[model samples]
Target: MARMISYCMRIIEIPMLYLQKRLGISRLAWVFLLPNLLLFGLFAFLPVVLNFVYAMTGSDQILLQDRTFVGMGNYQTLTSCEDFLNPNSCKDDLFWRAVYNTFWFVLLQVGFMVGFALLTALMLNSKIRARGFFRSVFFFPVLLSPVVVALIWKWILQREGLANAALEGMGFDTINWLLDRHWAFFWSVFISVWAHMGFYTLILLAGLQAIPRDVYEAASMDAASPFRTFRRITLPLLMPTMIVVLVLSLIKSVQTFDEVYAFTGGGPGSATTLLIQYVYETGFAGTPRLFGLASAASILLAVVLVILTCLQLWASRRNVNG
Candidate 1:
């Protein structure tokens, strides 16, 4: 193994020596970066440029050259509606529905995810049996693929699954959980929180542990109750970490797809459809795929994400400064 490594290093050194002489040492770094730069430009930058271009064009044709320039026609169509609150009144009703669903989903998911994460962090931070074991168990779900998480929940919530089975065992009639619009939305938020809560919990736990032991000791010396200690010391100290978690979870909730997609398929008659799913369906899944409309939706979604990204940066900077 050592000899094989030496031979490989020798082969690599030959090219490095040759390149160093040709490009000069300082400029040679660009050679190594060239491939990565090209890939970034091709995959990231080019798609962004094309998305803008596609947003300005019309027609169902996939190729850019084939599509006719329609200026902001796609954007206009999305915004064209008599009653903004009433999706049925819009030109593209589905877009408005998706926007509303996304709004609620983000609100509910972010709130519950952060709340439960903080609660779990508090519990885990306390002296308890199998604390380390429980921490590992909580975080294990975060390791699973989003699709896998969705499928697990989907099976458990289905008609004949354990959820219904439990209900029936108590003499309640078994009913489909995923087929009801309200229940489907509830499960979507619940599943999202369950899969991701551990991650935020770990962050909050770190913040909790970082609170100086002396502070808690002093609080105890004053006979501070648990609630008082938490409100005065723990909550204030944990605020920065909570802000970080809030921004991150907000972004993730806005860009929600994959798991929710696999779990509900934006179903119970488009009750759970989000902005990202709307983009996917418009661009790829639907017949006569409206690439222009999809690109416009994407641009809108990107704007929201950029705002959230800015919030994240501000929170991160503040955390570092303090």
Candidate 2:
């Protein structure tokens, strides 16, 4: 096997040597990156182009050629409303409800997720017993598949499941957690936070460790209170990482679907229905399967995501410049 590998490499080296001679060392980066670039173009760029094409064409047919061109019609349909405040007034009421739900989900999920992650990161960074074990314990959930996490939580939250049983044992009524709209929305946010907080905590923990110990020593020498030191020193140094966490969490929260789908099935009359669910149902699962409108909704979502990503990039560049 080694001899065969050597022979194959030797055969490949002749062409590589020729190409290196043609391109020179200065351009070798592109040569090294060419395969990945080609794959990205094929998988990433091609799909985006196709999605845009689908957005402009209207039809239930899977074939693009059979779809009729209806430029801007889907977008107009999605945006039109008699009263923007009331979703019932809109032509695409479900879209607006999804939008409204998504807006709240992003707000609550990102806010709570980042807050919990920061707190966990701070605790994990401090001197404590079994610190390594605790870190591992916190991060364990992130390693689980989203489906598995959802199923586990579903069992725990169900009426005849462990949670209700525990409640009954404790002499409290077993609340139907998933049946109520308010509780369903709450659990959707809670489960997402529980499942993903550790990853962000790890990021923030790294940011914490990168701060120099000598700075803290100086603060202590000056008799700074713990709160004062954290506020004055730690927060300033960690702002860049915080910004990164915020943007990433915000983007992830906006795109939430899989775990949510498995957990609540966007249940109790679209209480937990999000934008991605709306798009998925419209594009593939609904009776008519309005591909054009679904594509347009996804396009709108992509635009928001692009704007968020650009914000992150801008912040990073500014942080670096300083």
Evaluate all candidate structures by whole-model CA lDDT and list the values in order: 0.96, 0.93
**Compared with the true structure, what per-residue lDDT tens digits does model 2 show for residues 1-322?**
9999999999999988998899997897799999999999999999899899999999898899899999999999999999998999999999999999999999999999999999999999999999999999999999999999999989999989899999999999999999999999999999999999999999999999999999999999999999999999999999988998998888898999999999998887889999999999999999898999999999999999999989889877866875
Q: What is the TM-score of each candidate against the true structure?
A: 0.91, 0.90
Which candidate wins on lDDT? 1
- Lowest lDDT sum, 10 consecutive residues, model 2, at 313-322
Q: What would the per-residue lDDT of candidate 1 be over residues 107-225, giving only the tens digit for each residue? A: 99999999999999999999999999999999999999999999999989998898999998999998888999999999999999999999999999999999999999999999999
What lDDT would candidate 2 get against the real structure?
0.93
Clashes of 2: 0
Model 1, CA-based lDDT: 0.96
The numbered model that scores best in TM-score is 1
lDDT of 1 at 270: 93
| Worst window of 10 by summed lDDT in candidate 1 | 172-181
